[model samples]
Target: MVVSARITNFLAYSSLTVSRVSHLGNGSLRYQWLLCRNTSLLQLRSKIQTVVPSITSNVSVPKENIPTADALVRPDLEGLYEDIREGLTNTQPELRQIAQYYFNGEGKAIRPVITMCMARAINYHLDQNAPGVIQKQKKIAQIAEMIHTASLVHDDVIDVADSRRSRPSVNILWGQKKSIIAGDFILAMASGMLARLQNQQVIILLSQVLADLVQGEFMQLGARENKDERFAHYSEKTFKKTASLIAYSCQAVSVLSGADSTLQSIAFQYGRQLGMAFQLVDDLLDFIATSAQVGKPVAADLRLGLATAPVLFAAQKFSELNPLIMRRFQEPGDAETAFRLVLRSDGLQRTKELARQYCNDAVTQVAQLTPSPYQQALVTLAHQLLHRMK
Candidate 1:
């Protein structure tokens, strides 16, 4: 039997069919993935086609292809340090210490990197920032990282997590209450900085991202009884919990550059889709990756009773999972049972397709912007996400 699916809701619509077979270089199965491209995605697919396989290390990243991390962040590195230090500051030394607990200089900084590049790319003066605006845009990047770290601190408390980025989480290093306060302090600092930016629109945009984060957390705490509502709820929650900051950060930089609404929306759209795609990949990782790779335990989401994209898609064919999802997998053996079912089903494959669809939208969104190596790096970044096994 053959199964085909459309992961349209995430972005573009296209039915993909995967057949059981031999092998596809990197993995066990000889899957087409078709890696099918709908007409809407073709332009995007073609643009980044070369970069995808290379960044995936099917080949090398080569010297002259796109902007590297240094190429993008080096110029603004000193300012990022100043801005991040400023956000973590407090007169009370202990409070300041707790606030800076996660700033160990090991973060991937994907959000800030994207924001910095987007700021430069969207500026009317291509390949450069508009004088005073360059400094402000770098602040936006700094703020993005600060706000993201703040959320992670709170999330560790929320998830009762002990480790992040392969180290003891803030909640583990400090106590939960202290961790919570630190998270709040960081947020307050970020808010004060946001106010100082003095762009009401920027404040409103980032502020809304804050609200979405709350709503997304609440959504994660419960599951909808209806199948359709469950999927819709999960999608929105994914955006709120994962994508909002990335979306608004992109839009905020566009705003900083004095781009019009249409352009700002395009930037937001790119980030919104990219952020969701990022989380979907994370959800998928919970099942497929090892604890060592993800810097946490495997099946973390399922163990926590969260039905992510994989479980939801698996439920479409495995009736047993529907009841399990509704009950939050509280039954004695529910998580393991659901885990076994997902492993045997096409859920992983389908989820990958869904994520790819979003990346396609991400690529398309940025395609409209002025072309530069930075812009190409953005596209390269989206494709690189597909290859992140961890």
Candidate 2:
């Protein structure tokens, strides 16, 4: 979804990094795969070359992964996600089954993990003795993840997608109507968890994220005609769809941390900037990554009649793209021509530059937090997001 890159002076030279985005929903993985004993970096290098042949690799992946919440948050943190289905335990048998499908195996857990990390970081900033696990904030993390998974479930139906995480899509396994119900069930469960938190501010913050998801989907249904305006439209839609949850979730955790409004605003900014960067990288990858790599169709955006950052950038060099985007590629051969133009143009590179800028901005905003292992981990996360591959 939404996330960035930049190293701070306090961070070790060897920092956490994510080299791939292996899957989207259940079993979503990032970077740590290279550290798996069975998987080698050399193998990873060859795989990256094979999967994202369009983009030339530049940033070097570390042979050894630095310690971060990706590894640390497991086992003990498992409870945060493991039994979320229990929230719907009282539902009808089939309803519970569809709702709990993805919850069976956690995805990357990016939103919730970052939420937990932010809570401690902000607590340390306020001079509190932060606990290893704060119940309410952890609940917020769970809610964030629940909201994310729910959106993806609905997204599959909207995209008419057949697979997720290399597995049959919820809509594929169970018809679209059932998939829609399952997605709603997930959101309903998330809402229940949110209300139980009893923090009005938290409720309000996450509630906005819910609204943004719908608004983003609406935005996705069309594209702007003006070249410059299209980029703005795309970026704004990206913020609402992918970044909103991450940004607000971070802000929600900051609120729970009892941070002052100023600190809370900064925390929200950190998440927002990173979320923007994360989606930009994803847009670039659509042109670069294969269907086998990212677990979704390559150029899925184009197939959906959407114009992302890369296509917008390409339009500057090849004015012909403007008409295709406006028509939603309705004309025959439009999609193919646009694809070739994007590859030959510097669109991906330019888009990557913009993504990195946002990543850098994310780093700058989080730097305000008092230095803590949690804060450092957050910083390392932003840095690693730039190079995310899966």
Candidate 3:
């Protein structure tokens, strides 16, 4: 039987598939992952073309050759930080500083970039000769940044993180109490901006993201005993925490473009898939990336006693990890042991494979739209997320 190109490449790269790998004597799992890192460019190009023909006929082009989604949003994002700062300004100088801390143009602004790209793509889909992005669409991008940054501030407080993007966290500079208030302030401003859109449906859609963020945090604080249920819980939390904002922002842009329900749903699906892919890559990075590379602590999830995708996948091969996961990895050496075991297992590889699946789905979703540069950018953006180092 002919296997799908995705599965073929995935299986070909590793000497042992997950099912075939098991513990050998001396309690060590025996596996070798000889991936295509050393493959010639021509070979990689051929493989990508086979796996995702829908995105491009001639694939595996050098990074320079791909249409960069970042370029598409550069002009619009130029003044984004300034606009956010203006909105977050407060009478009290210290409060204003705290509220506007993350708007200093240091972060990647991935959410806004995705929102702007989706908005333009939806606009062009509805009208082949549509003008540049409308004011309301741009507002959505700004609101997305604010919502995302606000979450980061609150998360720093909860995670007790001292650094973010390689800089001191808000909670570290301003006490935890003040950081929480500053985060709330940013959210309030974002809410006001969202309301100004004057589209009741858009208002409701974006509002749901706020609720999802809170609920996701609550879910992250605990673990389930059942393996099946634990994975489900993790999936739900991932969606609520990361995908909710992106999915709704894309849908709101479609609605603002006057696209019908079908188009709106299409936009939502694309963003949902892309967002999930982005988070999976992030989770994988937590285990593999250095502090300088990720701009934060390495293995942060494990340090926080959170069992992310890599740890969960590793647990399947090592039953010892189950108790550690349930106890939140609080015991001495638990985090270190789990981290080492995950690296030895195929957990990181499996996470990357799952991320590729979501990225593929995202590409497929965006392809349904009328062909345009903006639409193509969306597809490229999904692929970029799958391979991003940070």
RMSD of each: 10.3, 8.6, 9.5
Q: Candidate 2 lDDT, tens digit per residue, 166-231?
A: 777787788889989988988988998899888899899999999988887887776554665665
* Alpha carbon lDDT of each predicted model: 0.70, 0.70, 0.73
Each candidate structure's TM-score, on Cα atoms with residue i matched to residue i, is 0.83, 0.83, 0.83
Q: What residue runs in model 3 are displaced by over 4 Å at the alpha carbon?
A: 1-63, 128-133
Q: In model 3, where is the ten-residue run with the lowest total lDDT?
A: 22-31
Residues 240-308 of candidate 3: C-alpha lDDT, one tens digit per residue: 888888999999888888889999999998888788778877787665554456665555676567888
What residue runs in model 2 are displaced by over 4 Å at the alpha carbon? 1-66, 130-133
**Error of model 2, residue 258, in angstroms:** 0.4
Q: Estimate the overall C-alpha local distance difference test score of candidate 3.
A: 0.73
Task: Provide the clashing-pair count of each candidate structure.
Answer: 0, 10, 0
State how far residue 355 of model 2 sits from its true place (Å).
1.0
How much is the lDDT of residue 116 in candidate 1? 80
